[model samples]
Target: MSRDNPTSLEQRLSVHLQPLYPDEDPARMAQACLEAMELSPSATPVKPHANLWSERDTVVITYGDSIRREAEAPLQTLRQFCHDHLSDCISTLHILPFFPYSSDDGFSVMDYTTVNPALGNWDDIETLSAEFKIMGDLVINHCSSRSLWFDNFRQSIDPGASFFYCAPGDADTSMVVRPRTSPLLREVETPDGVKHVWCTFSHDQVDLNFENPDVLYEFIKIIRLYLEKGIRWFRMDAVAFVWKKLGTACINLPETHELIRLLRLLIEHKAPDAVIITETNIPNHENLTYFGNANEAHLIYNFSLPPLLLNTLITGNCTHLKSWLMTMPPAQFGTTYLNFVASHDGIGLRPTEGLLSEWEVDTMISTLQRFGAKVSCRTNAQGEPKPYEINISLWNALQGTAQHGPDTWQYARFMCAHAIMASLEGIPAFYIHSLIATENDYERIENTGHFRSINRHIWDADALSDALQDTGTHHHKVINGMRRLLEIRCKQPAFHPNATQFTLHLGESLFAFWRQSTDRRQSIFAIHNISDQPQSLNLSELNLVSTDQWTDLISEQHFEDRVAQLELAPYQYMWLTNL
Candidate 1:
């Protein structure tokens, strides 16, 4: 351990490994772990030089197979589109789980070392990385049962027998937080005998046993493989349930935080600019624990924002949202939140557990369901079904009294929602579907029998190009609107992740906030009318300044004198800054 900093990796690894291997030599274990961090002598990796956690950084989350062409690989078409269309607005591309998978839309990864052959090869990934920084998912919680590791485990090989968790039948294991209503112990036949292994997500996705140091070392190698391929940001998927203990909720455990910190240190040591963002979709208080003294995740997903934002729009109120934001703990200097409205998965409701009332949540779920959204449920400890997530495109989620199909009012509403998201005090991520302004693909859901497929639409390259060229189309309106917003957002230093946020409690039908730059030289006042009806903003009470020289950046309009009172059209927003 270093004499200057006792909390360094050497000291922390010793403490973290003691409980897992009580009798083993901690010094030897730490040495082995450090040895694994070194790259193979024959390998030649690219030099990484991407800076993360910047105000100009806006992430676009998509799948490698999202956009396709007739003969070209999907990833190739995606890269072409990024170069030809989105190169200016998007700074980072978050390709979701591009590895080979068996089910769950790449969540059940069969091979972590290779890309899905159907969606281009490593050449395509490297090409995209050359243009824009890439973020990849480290789905380390579980692996596909069809993977070679699982097969070898079934054969009871020396190294494979201890790769996954196969618990004893007599062991006491009752208290566990189940994300899905699935069986905890899955029965499988090994060469030795029948075994019941821990399957946290699904029977097809078996959880690995971290109790074995071999698994940890193997994951370290997998991460290095990604680093060699040019992944600057790593998203840890479903990591809350990574470490488990009997007679407990099996989430946010002490071991889990230590493991995250350990990974953070190793990655920072390897690539000084590399960033790790944890995707823990739990409650607010529990999720913040991942930023353990700035030694864990550089960013944690703002899971509460989606549902709470929905509640604000649906109920025509921002009271709860304001209260939640006021209570949100500020991030450390280098760590911030990954704010997003929609992603590959559904809009999570668990993050809004205490922020919203039961009736309020019921109303949100019911309203979205009326607008053609699907709801997924999880079983509580009392064996009752509870709403877990609302699966729908964000465009449809914000649709209210605008008629279902393509309409200007619907587009305006979507833009308003995005404006509020962009003004938030963190890096804003837009889902690929949301960026293109596409609606629910009911045909996809009917054909695949997967509800999440509604938002996960497989787009054609030529059709997307045609739609973008046509100004009247849905894709053009939403994509261009977002591009303009990002253009202005990137130029504003007040939108930095470390900016200070002050909630302005105007009323129920409006959500307003002021974001000031860290140096306090620049500020932006963002106001949004969440309701369908027009509302008036009282400027007399705001006391912004002595003069009325303010400019609306979104509309590019200047206000000189009549700033006493202003009216906001239905679902309208403005980003006002002193000129």
Candidate 2:
């Protein structure tokens, strides 16, 4: 069927829905899906654009209330901060789950249509969206147990009576995979009888039943509402575990991918430039599956980059990092990676399952623990507790190398990480805390009794402004360095998200890669010394053209001799380019 034909809209919908609902009438469900999207059957469909993102795209992830002031709303404060400081570099602001919630910060959403009054109103979000692209979380896998939908389910009422997944007490679930160590089933009392509800993350967050068509319709309406409110990017949180079967590993089911394709189709038909990003923090191979044939997700989180990059800097060796990079397949057109070193949550270990050795993982975890980091655990199939993620601030996590304790190379190491991320073949996202160089908030963990809270610190806007103004503090230095790197990155056509990338072999001490612009008009050799010791690089190794003038973009130094040896300081990086 031709996607450009308006009649094929319904057919495409049935193509995705039939596999999900084999016994149901697919045509009727397709009509209902169109109704939910507020689109008529004959409405003109917008064609998906080939280039939706570019080299200038950079994202900053933060909570709605991450920075607060005395009287003004946090969102307003955040808007002012971005306009004043981040206007030149950042292109998108991902406000993490700004909805009313019962637990798990904002992930356990109580309502999907309304913004959290405590943070701000939709007007605040709309105002911010005027200056930057806004990314919102769908939180598709689960909802707060205290939500109105759950309340309806408890009373066996309409809209949500059959909204949640229920299983028999004796159902086989030993093969299920989850990130949390919490019990899988939560016993809830309904008017009918006692029912065991599926709780993938925690008992307070009940998983939804996608097997029910109404549930899918409800989220389609929610997606439309977000689009009306200026949310250009939809981050599908914990989407991999949305479908389940009793005796199988409940993660990454085929039904889930079909649903993602359906959502992407609906979203793009309405707004051609809107993006759908999947947040699957599983193993690298499984995570890549979210981008099925360039139809499912517009972007997938580069989950392995965090642990691998962290290990490279901490261990001062790039053997594992280089190996992993060489094996990764470049994303197809209209799809790419969302690269980041840290976010609201901890650095997940699951992505390193196949990339790093057992001893290497254990050593990295121990070193992070020595630096005052906490480890969160999950239950294995055999019921053994295993480390799931390392909970620490990015600033503190890179205090020193594993071979040697804390050292004087912290600033250089920190800046080097961002340089590499910005130069990679994806849109680089930086957590707000990382840009400010915020340390782990042990006090927050003590207050909230959650390991993830260690990295989720609330900053006072006044104090943060003062800290950034003081040139002596690392906060000022880090933000300044980040802005400089991003400014340089946005000007280079070779840094486009879909540019050609090839891993360069410069031995384990130095990590290098070559990226050429899609038009082939520009080329950049991104080289970094991921060690504390100075390293020498022969210019001949880069194969620079003798006719063209070569220059280092970072230091703005012109290379006069093609064969001259260059010494890089500890944790130093260079963007060698020929314009």
Candidate 3:
């Protein structure tokens, strides 16, 4: 069926809605959905551009208050900082959840429609959106227990009375999957009776009942409002556990995927340039399902990259990393991966289910612990505590190798990881802290009593500006190095998000890959020495064209002979390209 046809759209909506709402008339519900989106049945479908993203597109994820100044809203300060430093390299800004919230660092949303007054207002977001494509979180899975919706539920009022999911106290929920070890059901007193409301992440975050169509309608309106405010990229945060069934694992259910498709359909119809990104921190195979024949998420987070990359750099071996990369299928057009080494949260271990062995994971965890990283755990099906993620900044995580312990190659190793990420066939996102090479903030962890707080350090804007200007600090060096790489990457066609990528069989000590532009006009051999010892590679190994000149994009060095030997220092990487 043609997606642009009005009749086909209605049919598609009905097909997606039937499984989700078996009792309702799908046609009626579909019409109501169109009404909610303020779209007519015959409205022309706005076709998305052929190239939604490109090599020039890079993202930086940061909290609104990550860099703060006195007597000014944090969003304003963030805007000024990005304009001054990131405007040249970064094309998008992912301001993590700026909505009014009760807890969980803006995840537990209190009012989805209003911006957090502490940060700024919609005007500030609109202004920032004008300068850069803005990515906002659609915290669709749950809401704050202190929200008006939840409060109204307690009073048994309209809208909220049927908005929350509740089950009996003795209901069996042993098969449910969640990232938190918190109790699945939270006891609440309502006018009708005592309710055991579902809490996927924490007791303070009450899960919304998507079984009720009203909830879906509410989110559609929220998406519309965000588009009006110029937020083109929507990050569905913690979306895996949105739907639940009694006797099955709650995460990644088919109904959840259907909901995503419905949202994607509606969003694209409204704003052709809008992008829907799913934040599912699950196993590799299951995470791939979010692409859904190119009908679901426009971008899925490369969840396995962080832990695997950390292991590769720390152990000086790319056997596992190479194997995993070789197995990954390139993303289809209209969809790609969002690759990153760090974010506001920790390095999720769940995505490493089959990629890394138990011993390898334990060893990596222990090594991170030695570098002052904290481990967060979740309850498994057998009710055993297991490591969920490692909470530490990227700079601290790469302080040294597991064999040699902390060393002087921290700076080089850190840059090597990012360089490899940049050269991969995907859009690279940098966390604000990682760009500045911030260390673990144990002080924030102690203050908040949360392990993730270690990586969520808030910087004073003036102090950070001074550090960047000093040039002697690692902050200055890391940011400058990142900018240079991104600037160079943006000009290369081989680095396009959907470019062809093939893993190179260099060695365990060196990780390498070949990327060719879509039009076959440019080729790049991205190689990195992950070991602490110097490594050598014969230029002939790459089979470079004898007639065509080749150059290292990073150092601008010319390779005169195909058989010439190239020496790479420890933690060094090269982008050998033929333009």
Candidate 4:
């Protein structure tokens, strides 16, 4: 083609995207942007993606009230503790969302840009952000509804501020919202007439209107603000409902994906290393969307693991656990799963809600129904169970915490979970209290009248003197066990995630799998007995030529001779390192 009718590379690429992002300046959009990465042709497809997390790389996470005041601040001490023990192995740290929210924990925010003075001043946050940044990884996600952007959307009386999406033009309608399913009904007074806004889970969390270009820009500014402070990861909080359309469940909309991709494109051009993590609390099926092209979230939470981990504890069995493990897909092979036993919010009854039989969910819902909890999604109309709040309390109370004794039935349940979470297939997270086996803050719930009690207790690393499995003080064992696992994992590069996992089922109680590297230098195999009774197994099935002298990383013990048979103690665990 002649120069006048040229189909040059620059023109071709420019014309390709000009129509879609018309608002983005074409000249600026042509500026260097990060290319989407796919597996290299030379790379093996079966290998697991390497870990962004390393035992020696340092991990920093923030939690509790960033707004907590008049309380002896533990953030400084926590930082010191992380530095003291981790030194180099763990590097990046993430703080929980402390943006101003409309109760229901801090999940729903009222203003995004403003720091909730209760946690600390913006100066304090900036100071801390600097401290963490210079030392290593510091990250915070753009907040929920509490953001100024959302506030503008929720801002009625001002038609000029179209930053947020309102429910039709009905800000004033009369409707009573029973916060809980109990008889205590609360009026949600709206403008004009008191009409109730669809809270979905709670009454206050009004969805934002991302359709407005202003809201998108505001979030971009929010992202830039945190990045300016040296935050490396931004946890995209509650992203499932970001963009909604009519006649749909108003979730995971096409616009939502477009919005996320656009944000990703922006981040790629500006902050290449900055990572986005999605905090969707749905099952694995729904949660997978967050990892959009591996470009969306650098990591996604392993939410499904918790309840199943709990179920394994109660039944002392691994069948269900094995099945779930099989369902895990390699959206992007080798990417890390942010595994956790507990988090800032309450434990959700997700993932498994789809897997479990209706009868099982019904039974649990009925139990909660008897307690005045109203169940939704996974529950029937016969029971008005408060699935949201009660699930949180019940999960925390029943775990192998110091709250209940060995005879309390919940004792073994807690212990069983301990073994599973520490050995699971992802980056395991330790809830502040869960680390020390802190008991459930039942009184906090009773006092707060909401889930904020989940965040009430202070974290004292040295306060616990109880045994790891000692009733409620189960934290010591769990921490050390996790530390030891990570330590062993770091010793071998093969554990770095370029490996494949092959699972083996030896009866219902014994669950075993190996994270095997191609070179076989760091093939790590773990066997767990989530059973009330001891399990004995044959070695022929596992391809182990020599079973003598296999080291138990957590207990620091060595077991000799499983050439013929291997025995697992009740609620036992084993991690074998390959030569």
TM-score for each predicted model, relative to the true structure: 0.94, 0.98, 0.98, 0.75
Write the residue-wise lDDT of candidate 2 on 1-579 in tens digits: 544342578888988888999999988999999999988666666654376899999999999999999898889999999999899999999999999999999999999999899999999999999999999999999999999999999999988899999999889899999988888999988999998999999999999999999999999999999999999999999999999988889999999999999999899888788999999999999999998998899999999999999999998899988998888899888899999999999999999998999999999999999998999999998878999999999999999999997999999999999999999998999999999999989999999999999999999999999999999999999999988999999999999999999999898889999999999988999999999999999999986887888889999999999999999999999999998
For residues 220-302, what per-residue lDDT tens digits would candidate 3 score against the true structure?
99999999999999999999999989999988999999999998988888888999999999999999999998889999999
Task: Supply the global lDDT for candidate 2.
Answer: 0.93
- Which parts of model 2 are misplaced by more than 4 Å? 1-7, 43-49
Cα lDDT, model 2, residue 455 = 94
Candidate 1: TM-score?
A: 0.94
Task: List the global CA lDDT of all models.
Answer: 0.83, 0.93, 0.93, 0.52
lDDT of each residue in 137-200, candidate 4, tens digit only:
1112223444454343344444214543446433432232222343211233334343233444
Give the clash count for each candidate. Answer: 0, 0, 0, 64
Which residue pairs show backbone clashes in model 2?
A: none
For candidate 2, the 10 contiguous residues with the lowest summed lDDT are: 1-10
Clashes of 2: 0
How well is each residue in 357-450 modelled by candidate 1, as lDDT tens digits?
Answer: 8988888888888878998877788766788889999888877732232334677778887888888987899998898988888999998787
Clashing pairs in 1: none
Indicate the residue-level lDDT of 51 in model 1.
31
C-alpha RMSD in Å of predicted model 3 compared with the true structure: 1.5
